[model samples]
Target chain A: MASKKDPRTPAQIKLAKQLGAAIAEARKKAGLSQDELAYRCGLHRAYMGFVEQGRYSITVATLVQVCSELDAKPSEILDEIGH
Target chain B: MASKKDPRTPAQIKLAKQLGAAIAEARKKAGLSQDELAYRCGLHRAYMGFVEQGRYSITVATLVQVCSELDAKPSEILDEIGH
Candidate 1:
């Protein structure tokens, strides 16, 4: 179990938070509803919501699909998230 | 648009693919149904499936949530995925 106090490090955790928020923002910018994004990416609406909330770690495949749906790339997403 | 001829570098893509698979494997190992994991991590279940398939790029916040659900750290997840 990760320690509640900075479970990991602040830098990584901060990076993750920003990244998650960026993805959510990007998804919205793309005019994608959670379900729409999910459908396009072959993801579940619930999972898409989870991702938006930054409550789960994601796989590369998921990232790719999300990017594809957004018409973006990993680098662009990463840049948005400041990572 | 990313070129189909190695949209990204093969190494990065490969690393992403492996990382995606590792996350899926870890999610399963944690005895977490995608929905259950999503619930625990405050995620959407559909995104979980997308992640499992390595179809998308994930945010750090999402990564943290997923890792928390799996009782793992980012390093561990990265290590598992060979990134």
Candidate 2:
């Protein structure tokens, strides 16, 4: 049986972290804590923490939720990456 | 054990489909087939099909891969979602 292991590449991991940092900065600028933002976005606090820490591979849908709660545009958040 | 069902909302599903359509448009404009794009991105063709069909909740990393293959930006693809 072939094992299916899709480990993220280093570049992918770095990108995730960059995205997380961007989200954290936006959340702070909006005066929201991780838990508070998570609650407002209907996400689990721990999951939100993971998202902020760049430990989770976030979906576009989830990104929209977070961006909505932060009152920030998706482009604003993504623009922070690769910069 | 508590069930951990994180079903996507209708809005999320719609957004995913929109994103998918945007990707398909970009890919076509770039003159790349789904399989060719998938091959370049190291993704399965079947999975690429699902992504084009907007049937999958794509992760940011995967989105980056597809965008890279399409020579497009994340913002460009996302901009098509809510319009």
Error of 2 at A23 (Å): 0.3
What is the per-residue lDDT of model 2 for residues B45-75, given as tens digits with 9 covering 90 to 100? Answer: 9999989888899998888889988889887
Where does candidate 2 chain B have its weakest 10-residue lDDT segment?
B74-83
The sequence of per-residue lDDT tens digits that candidate 1 reaches over residues B1-83 is: 87456455565466656666877788788887888987887667887777766655665556656777787666556644533
Cα miss at A81, model 2 (Å)? Answer: 1.5
What lDDT score is found at residue A16 in candidate 2? Answer: 82
lDDT of every model, 2 decimals: 0.67, 0.86
For model 1, residues A37-69, the per-residue Cα lDDT tens digits are 889876788987877776566655566557777
Chain B TM-score, model 2, reads 0.87
Model 2 alpha-carbon drift over 4 Å, by segment: A1-6, B1-6
Looking at chain B only, the TM-scores across the models are 0.74, 0.87
lDDT of 2 at A69: 83
Worst 10 residues of 2 chain A by lDDT: A74-83
